[model samples]
Target: MNHRCPAVLVHGWRSHPGIWNRLAPVLSDTAVPFWRFDHTAMQGAGTETIALALRDYIRAKREETGYTGPVDIVCHSMGTCIARYLLEVLDGDAREEQVRQLVGIGPPNNGSAMAELFNDPERGPEVIRRLVGVFVPEDYDPGDDTIVQEFRPRSRTIAALRRAGTRDDIAYRILLGANLTATPAFFPVFSGKTWEFAPDGGWRTTYAGDGIVPHSDSLLPGAQVDVFPTDPANLARNPELYCHTILPKNPELVARVRDYLTLSARPAARTPPRS
Candidate 1:
């Protein structure tokens, strides 16, 4: 019997299961089942509410499969936050659920600074305009976005995540992209740099990010982080594909995720070589 844990895939905000279309094949194996969780139906719902639904989905899957073994969770962007809330907050205290690994791609573990930027009175409008055609639609409104609000730097959801902390039993792996070329093709809005909130109450851009999530934002005390395309030439070759929105489909990133999910043990973090 194949005892390898099942893999659960979670898509980020404003994203659909299609994002995993490229990765699903690599992760597909006769022994390991790939379960994709679609949150599009709950687009306007809060993270907690969506997470509750996720809990129910997992429970139902377990009941249907009769597989009580640990499952590996692979999520992207905001979906990472939702998965963490379910694993570390809701299931943390009880320690009853079985989750072997939590792999997050371009996750906003420290809360999304972009969410904060969207609500900024001075910069919100321009930022929204820049991301309209690319990351969001022309009619996008952060105020009307409950999930976005919950992911802001100082939101209650972020606070709860901090208080709950990560579970020791689960291995955490984070994959982040670096915009080495600083090309607009990588991400036009921020020019390949990620938005970050400074301690002095100001916004700044940094290259140590995937044009959406800054390295600092995804860094957790115990989680291992790996930046993609250790060679700058690789990113220079196809800068557009390394952006936040398209990361899940990037071939190189998908391969790394495959290795992480299938490897017998957690590997050491791989940092990009300094230019």
Candidate 2:
């Protein structure tokens, strides 16, 4: 498909442009021209900082590519948070119109409890509190801070963003990671005693969710939602679907993104014949 507008790929927290390395070729395969957004220090950068950087990138892309049409956006994790701020919070009439569709991979659209888990001074361990603070900025006044404030479940920024929802002129697609059977070994280390044994009686703990953001938190209120299996083995076997970390490499995801960009859909996957 010959896209009139360029597709922009935004990487989430503590990430670089290299995150798109696996996904870019698939987009190119469909003849979709794309751009990767580069930003600094997800660990330290606030939401406003990331938003302004994205704004600059959009402006630069428009000038450099000389494309007057709307740009399609693809984002992962916290990158979607930044994109939402740009779309819902920023006041740019022309820029707003220039966004055609937004495809988010593993976004915390409704805010993540993970933030509140750490930000809760009364309950959260002191060490974890400091570490979590790096990613989530604190809310001081009624309407300030940046990344941290915006991601807390009950924060003013998140509530406002939720109320705004997606723009009428823009289309949205949200991909979710549903299974959370696997978690990093370090999660236990950081979780302290936060993880408890299941009352249902098994060798397992509670469903920790995608190892990061919970599945429920990933859904945007008004967007079309697509759920992918989050079991690592299933993801590995499918190769076409993804968990949060490898979303860009998921073949199914790449195809959907291409379809979204081209304004067309690939035929539904056919079931293989039983031997």
Candidate 3:
């Protein structure tokens, strides 16, 4: 814990911080004040509620880490959307500059299977509720998925960041997998409705997907696409590593993310952020 304005890692949907277990130590080894936080706020808490809660959490983290100014946010999967909300929507560009960098891994920046689920009448109800139980209740609506609403190229989030934007001042990096497939975890999309789940056949998302996110949606149309593997995934066997949520397990992916967060970043000493 030596980096003053150390990096804070955020994990994605239906997942815990354990996903970064192997990776955090690597960040720690960087001599940065690295930590992972619980994502209780992102679940089904809706947009504004989750945003304010996360805004408070980030403020607390920055203060606790003794960060004098901006802090890097390294996010995974759906966590990227949360990070975007924190910087772009919650605090706006004025405060976003305090963010040194945003490293998004396996981010469905365009949207997610959850977006597909949230939009699907059959699956959206069960997945959108903040509470997870065996049986899904009758009525639920997550309003509008910020990912679908706020993350697009011309999106309020992106547009706002772009307006208050700075290339050198605030960095953005996106990393996504290509060995994509359909997520079977979602309830089948066919409940006899005009809205079909696998519009592209049994796939729960777009044609070129990472099992959880469409490859195309992984990055905003014009945003930096960063890097992709040399090979496309085998749709049949569908390697487990290609799954939307499996990024932390791969040494290569971890290294890529590690490098992304650490590149050109000078090291600083550890201290609780100033409140």
Candidate that scores best on TM-score: 1
Tens digits of per-residue lDDT, candidate 2, 233-271, equal 663354324445667666667767777788886333221
Better of 1 and 2 by TM-score: 1
**Better candidate by TM-score, 2 or 3:** 2
lDDT of 1 by residue, 123-203 (tens): 989888988877889889999999889998789999999999999999899988887666666676776677877668788
What candidate 1 gets wrong by more than 4 Å, as runs, is 29-31, 264-275
Query: Judged by lDDT, which candidate is best?
Result: 1
Ranking by TM-score: 1, 2, 3
Candidate numbers sorted by lDDT from highest down: 1, 2, 3
Candidate 3 C-alpha lDDT tens digits along 66-107? 666667777777677777766665666366547777788777
* lDDT, candidates in the order shown: 0.85, 0.64, 0.56
List clash counts for every candidate, in order.
Answer: 0, 3, 12
User: What TM-score should be assigned to candidate 3?
Assistant: 0.65
Which is better, 1 or 3, measured by TM-score? 1
Candidate number that wins on lDDT, 2 or 3: 2
Show the lowest summed lDDT stretch of 10 residues, model 3: 266-275
| Residue 187 in model 2: lDDT | 32
